[model samples]
Target: MRYRHILAACVCVTLATAWHSKATDDIAELPPMGELSRAIGPMVETMLNGGVAVGLAIEDVSGAGMYSHRADEPFVLASNTKLFTTAAAAVSLPPDYRWRTEARWEDGSLWIIGHGDATFHIIDGYSYPDHFLDQVAEALEARRIDAVDQLVIDARYFDAAYQHPDWPRNQLRRRYSAPVSGLPYARGLVRIRRGRSSVYSTTGDPIATVTNFLVRGLRKRGVKVERARRAGIREVQPPEFTSICRHECPWPLEKVLRETNAESDNYLAEHLFKTLGAEFHGRGSFDGAAEAVRVALDAAGASLDGFTQLDGSGLARAENGGNRASAATVTSLLRAMSKHPRGGPFLRSLAISGRRGTLAHRLDKGPMTGAIHAKTGWIRGSLALSGYMRRDEDRVVVFSILVNYNAPHTYDRRQVVLSFQEELLRAVWDHLDAVDTGWEPPPPALVQALEPGRPAN
Candidate 1:
């Protein structure tokens, strides 16, 4: 009976959402770019010849232009998945929605629930919230609560699957690609500053150091919580005396999203993926998040029939433990995100070429510099890039390009294949100006390079 009731409630919710989606369907019309396609055809062929399966999408924000090729296919999005996670958060959570790192007073004791916010510590000038424990204590004192008896921590929001099976075990040692956690703090990492004590030493000694704001805050609060501990514990353990009273909470949503996108943090992606369901569906299960994404895709009229998803973060997957999404579905989601009320925030969070985020190193000093804001993804042999591209005449273009099977087996061959795919995209962008005029005669060097039977660089 309860199941039936839940089903009925879901149906009603779906209908209401469907009507809402239908109301927003009248986006601006897209313009045609046939000449642009022909110009980019050879370049794409070259990538195919080099053994890459590619998916690409280009749509003008003004509703004046659009194009797609294999945009419907499923390719591992890698960190590009963070775009969806962040967008979903903006839609589900309030624009100013804050993930509270709460300090609770129970029986004259203080308990804190770790809500995963990655930027709660100082690294390279970015510091955790100053005097966080003092603020919590101040809030408590304002309420006339005199003291805390003990400390209790609740991190039951997410499950025990700290690491996904699809990920390489060695990745756990790295900060950028640490395993996901429900109550992650300080980016779920500790920086190890290594130096040589003496040049004559026979071996290099490395020291691992941690910057735990939560511990520091608790100590200041007259509460004694140990510093630089591992992620989880089976039972609560407080200090012998209640002499300390400081604790640390996570960072703000905007700052968290910025770090996740700019650095392409893998753990952040996983945590955000699970957070979608926790916020909306009342659960943090990966399946719940997958269902939310599926429902959204269905409402958008995109098909996701054949792909297999192993994990929300694209981490390693069990036989059927993960959920799947495609380039087409992602593009549609991006379009919807663009139309969302807080879409501007999501768009700006992406890395811009030659300026900030992952794109800072690539496309530097290129025409696309400062014109492209996108997320990037990479795995053993796959590469995916998708987001909004600022184009000629102030046009905003949405695009997704995935390059899979770049090399049959060899590593160098794979790099060449990936480079070919990038060239294809560059060519497509270059040909847009040709739309207002006929194709220009090929210059001598250009003619030879693009001649029939000529090899693609």
Candidate 2:
């Protein structure tokens, strides 16, 4: 009857803590980092031994920065780049935005046109694999149309770049690197679970596949589709077709964004990225998306002084000069999102530590379980964690801990660096989760002491 995904998200979110608006007063009450510093001295030393490049920043949403260690230096963001893209999209796109597609009948042809919707079967899925197509067939049946001479899958709505140029050509077939199209189903990937197993990944051209799938569906529904093919960008115009049925994504922008951040979905991220450009620049392409993102950040008052964006999914790596940003830039964006009208959903979208998404297993559970809501990113040489840590009930703090372990994979330092990050946050959450009674600005000695190889003073 409808499509259903066995692993659909079963999540609960109550949105973000209210924005902390008393900036000046909060600064006066800023917490001291002395305790956090002491707790991380050994951890940092060990990571340094393993050849790690650390960039950390922790800031009070209602106040100012509490501690910083080379926080201004830009580092490869990995999937952390998703934070910026999603944040920008939150601000620029309408709060209630939803993607839509239409099926049309014209000149004895059936045409399916898409406007950037990849959300299918991931949430509350339809029972049938392609319920939307079935619905189209039923609609045609209701209209007493028995057959169509041709079926066309039109994906020209989005540019045919298909894949990001900066992405490694070898990894194009990986599920994480699934190609994007104007109209996508199941994030443009077909699951290959075997004998009750849960894992799956294989790539196929979505437009071509859907066209054929729909043809079979129509044939099964007592309609004959003589031919099926993908439509080019300039193939069909408004006057050339008559709308049959239109379908809108069941989820709104907020919910889609939750999936974007919670699942770290590259396909959703890229489509939304291009949608931004299409909305602002009248066409969906990498360049347009980049410019639109900048505008959104500018509108949010988030600074990207040293940030460089190449693609939406942060799939770009150091070898090809991927997305880069400073810890300060990350915190700045988080802080702005806290006060934004859409901040609640934005915060709620982040993956929870020891609870769900990428961090469901990390942070070691216990009091820290479900308490830390953040996004985790990892690639060959880089790892990033950025988001909010609830101070109590109505308050929160923002932080970004980015590490680069590219020196040598001979003995992967992932465990060591990961331990450093976990213990550091554990200390912040358990011991120094509040402001210092009497605090002062970070001194020159402290800043100098934190310079990578240098010992803490």
- lDDT tens digits by residue: candidate 2, 12-66: 1111112122323423333345776665554544344334567788776654766
Residue 399 of model 2 has an lDDT of 88
Clashing pairs in 2: 2-126, 2-127, 2-128, 3-126, 3-127, 3-128, 31-435, 31-436
Model 2's TM-score against the true structure: 0.82
* Model 1 residue 152 lDDT score: 50
Tell me each candidate's TM-score: 0.69, 0.82
Candidate of highest lDDT:
2
Q: Please provide, for model 1 over 1-457, each residue's C-alpha lDDT reduced to its tens digit, 9 standing for 90 to 100.
A: 2222332333222223212332222111223357776655545444443335566666554333356656666676666667666766656666666655555554465555555444444556745555465677676667676444444555546655555556666665655455455555555554454584322111111111122455556567655543333324455534442333344334456666766776777666677767666666666666676666556544444445544544555555333333335666666666666655555556667776677777776555567666666787776556778876555433455677776652334545444544554565566567665544322332232212111121112
**Minimal lDDT window, size 10, model 1:** 200-209
Query: Scored by Cα lDDT, where does model 2 land?
Result: 0.72
Question: What lDDT is reached at residue 127 by model 1?
Answer: 56
| Model 2: CA > 4 A from native | 1-33, 121-129, 190-201, 318-320, 410-412, 430-457
